[model samples]
Target: MKRVINFWSLLGFISVSAFLATEIAVVAAAVVWGISSLFGLAMVPTIALGILVGVPSLYGMVKATILAFQAETDPENN
Candidate 1:
């Protein structure tokens, strides 16, 4: 039982980390694209597109992290 719990916890941690990393990457890419556009890179429209897509992705990641932490700490479900 202990081993199973540990495995699940580890899996959860990995899942959250992967999601967060992806979100951070998206945000970083968007910022870079936006900055590049300022230098007349013709990517302003693409940067806008990135912002439109990245915001929701980031929000979902934050929500997932909160939910995962709650699941890990809450005793009611266990």
Candidate 2:
């Protein structure tokens, strides 16, 4: 019922967040290393690399979250 659905949703959210975090971390690390090798400054390169890798994921997450909120709020859903 409701409790079961809520549990599954919570689990799904946790798993998805963990997966995304891991993906972002790996991509950010790789990008930072690559950029640092090319440019020789670890800090700025890492920040830039993180931003480059993280932005698209962030955008997609925001879009999906907004869509989910919209669906939840839709009168037809009620």
lDDT of each candidate versus the true structure: 0.67, 0.62
Q: How many residue pairs clash in each candidate?
A: 0, 0
- Cα TM-score per model: 0.50, 0.49
Off by over 4 Å in 2: 1-5, 42-78
lDDT of 1 at 26: 73
Predicted candidate 2 versus true structure: per-residue lDDT over 12-45, tens digit per residue: 5556656656675677668767777788877776
Model 1, span 1-78: residue lDDT tens: 222346677577668767776877777677767666676555676677677767767777777677776665455645
**Model 2 TM-score on a 0 to 1 scale:** 0.49
Deviating ranges (above 4 Å) for candidate 1:
1-42
Pairs that collide, model 1: none
The worst-scoring run of ten residues by lDDT in candidate 2 lies at: 1-10
Q: Which ten residues in a row have the lowest lDDT in candidate 1?
A: 1-10
User: What lDDT is reached at residue 26 by model 2?
Assistant: 75
